[model samples]
Target: MGEEFLVNLKYSPDIPHSVDVIEAGGLTKYYGEFLAVDHISFRVKKGEIFGFLGPNGAGKTTTIRMLTGILKPSEGWVRIFGLDTGKDILRIKEDIGVVPEMANPYIDLTAMQNLFLVGRLYGMRKGEIRERGEELLHLFGIYDKKDKKVRSFSKGLRQRLSLAMALLPDPELLFLDEPTSGLDVMSARLIKRIIRDENKRGKTIFMSTHNMGDANELCNRIAIINHGKIIAIDTPEKIKSMSKGHTVIEVSFEPFKFKPGDFAYGEKIEIAGDKVRIHTRYPDDVIKEIVHYAEKNKLKIVSLTSRTPTLEEAFVHLVGDESE
Candidate 1:
């Protein structure tokens, strides 16, 4: 657990120079017969924050693991800065940094010790480690508690330490999986600002997240995955425009007794008294389904209206079935 606490961030990996920081070609993975990731291919240019988005079990994590060399792919190939991920994984990782999903710093050690452990593992001299580590601690606002045992730290503090450790080496390429998955509001904001700052400083970032707002704001381009495949890939503006302001339908059923499962047309369902507010992309289909359900149940239709989705309501809509 203590060893796993080592975090890394890079403005450059072991590669001295490269145009595309990451090149994945037909990356695929399987757990025996169950395919976790299909033939997904993409390129991440240098210095841009690329977002990976998907619903639960959509192969985002599997892809990241393959990119970072944590898990070997079942098929296909990947290159990091022109170096083959399958062959030169160690070299590719030498100067890069990663903050895995829910990554944690060593709770058993002090924050400074955790940093030192990670820095030494990266082959940094003590002086260099101290200089860079202290700077990151100060930058992350954890300088005041650098000597405190991380076991006593809050979740937010542990998260900040993880990022600090990752950036200790000043890497040029960074990979993060759900960097702000379960953080407090302030912590999340602070980490997001740091991520943007890193990218601004010419560091290439590959980040996977479930937060649509985060993806829309932090990523220059995004790829949405579903069912082990790349369903969509485009700039956030273009993607949001595709599903802009999801169709919202407000219907009042006379019976006022319908389970949420009774509707399949809506992505989200909420009920209050006689009203059911459904958020969906297919408003017309949902409306028809509501009418049909009411007729079949021998109930009267109180009222039905289609409401425009708010700008803030825009989120990437998954393709295909809604399982999981």
Candidate 2:
């Protein structure tokens, strides 16, 4: 089973273990007088998925742009694959694949044609393009649509095609900006699976996402940026531990009328659809109050569960103060 699984592995023998595939020091970007990215420094190890997360107006986009050479940094420096991102961008481009947040295929072309164009741009041989293109089409579950015009495809399919084009080169490193954003459930799930598989096949991926669950699930390490600065960078567990260390009690009752004041121990209370999400340091006390409230109000507890802090909670804790 292990041998079979390793059959598709493409881990590079050239890059040694623990080597930094990407290094940035004091990377900053400015739009006129407004600072878009402050001095930020970080490293991405080879063969790992590193996540960059932030709110909408945060510096995530600017940082990614600088990393991919879309926008030159106002200050600091970036090195990818041991080559300077600014000075050796053309050379660096050869070993990297980039999928922007709003990646798109040529609307006038078919899916297969789009891949062919990417292959040509990468200077791949015709035979190699055909074989690799077919493989990617099948991998992305868009094989049946290879001949279909991209203009007629749905958003999910277009995103799939964009990803396929990015992967067509089989580059050692991938820069994906919101790779699964606005995608359908199945499409999003499929893309996440592909991310894991690609990492297993020895690809280093730098991805940015607003989805905390995706960051927690997919990232080997995460960097949270706020107000043009990186506030926290660490493994998801370690970062989550940095939160107020509250236990989250998710409970839903029949006809819940309990107000936020009802749970005296709850530090934060939020309404999630029909459920109440309560964060409390004193879980025992909050749980008892929930039971008492249910009993007195003649409410039936539909479900109740408790878990430790999540990345979302940690993220909120870390960036809440900076929110406008």
Candidate 3:
């Protein structure tokens, strides 16, 4: 069994262990007089998924473009694999796969043809292209539609084909921007699964997304940006811990007859139908008060659950404060 497992394993020999695959220092960007990205410094270790998270127009795309060498940074620098992006763009690009936001495959070509074109652009040989393209199509679950014209495909199919094309060369690092944006449930899940599989194969992934679920599920470390500034950077658990002793308690009653203000123990309370969500720093005290209130009102508690703060909550807490 061990031998069989070893035989089936795939490895990326190019990525050095325990090294920074991407490094940025004081990275900034300006469009004319308006600042698009403020000074941001971060490092992405090899073989980990690093998430860049922010709302729309928060300089996420600008940071990605600069790191990919598509746009010049107005100040500071980024280095990939110890090579400066400005000076070694061609060399750096050879080992990186990029899936930009809303990227589309060639409409006039078939899915296989699109992969073939990408392979050719990377100077892959005929046999190499054929083998890798087919593998990528199968990996992305679009092999059966390989010969179908891209124009006839759905948005999800097009996005999958674009990702397949990006993976044709089996690059060491992948840069994905909102990879699941506008995708349906199944499509989004499939994309996320593929990302996890790629990370297991030792690929370094730098991803930018507004989807908090994706970041919480996949990222080893995340940087939260807002208004051109990165306000927080850490593991999801650590960032969520910034909620600082806050907890959310949700309760459902057999017969609803209470208003949010009637509790008078929570920092914030929200009522929806038969359910109530209470936020508080002292969960035990709040729970005791809730039990006392239920007994006094002769109400039966149907169910109750307590939850820690989520990535979305942490993000909103950080960015919302900045906005205010």
| RMSD in Å for all candidates | 8.4, 4.3, 3.8
Weakest lDDT window of 10 consecutive positions for candidate 2? 9-18
lDDT of each residue in 220-300, candidate 1, tens digit only:
999988889997788887665566336678888776768879988788888856789898878888988999999999888
lDDT, candidate 2, 1-324, per-residue tens: 345424433434443233678999999988999998999999998778999999998988788889989899999999987678878888778779888888679999999999999999999999999999999999999999999999999888998999999999988899999999999888999999999998998899999999999999999999999889999999999898788846889999998776767766788898898899988888899899889989999999999999989898899899895555
Look at candidate 3 and tell me the lDDT of residue 294: 89
**Sorted on TM-score, highest at the top, how do the candidates line up?**
3, 2, 1
- Candidate 2 versus truth, CA RMSD in Å, comes to 4.3
Name every residue pair that clashes in candidate 3.
Answer: none
Ordered from best to worst lDDT, the candidate numbers read 2, 3, 1
Q: lDDT score, residue 67, model 2?
A: 94
Winner on lDDT between 1 and 2 is 2
Which numbered prediction scores highest in lDDT against the true structure?
2
What's the lDDT for all of these models?
Answer: 0.83, 0.89, 0.87
Better of 1 and 3 by TM-score: 3
Q: Which residue runs does candidate 1 get wrong by more than 4 Å?
A: 1-16, 244-316, 320-324
Q: Which ten residues in a row have the lowest lDDT in candidate 3?
A: 9-18
- Clash pairs for candidate 2: none
Clashes of 3: 0
TM-scores for all candidates: the values are: 0.75, 0.83, 0.90
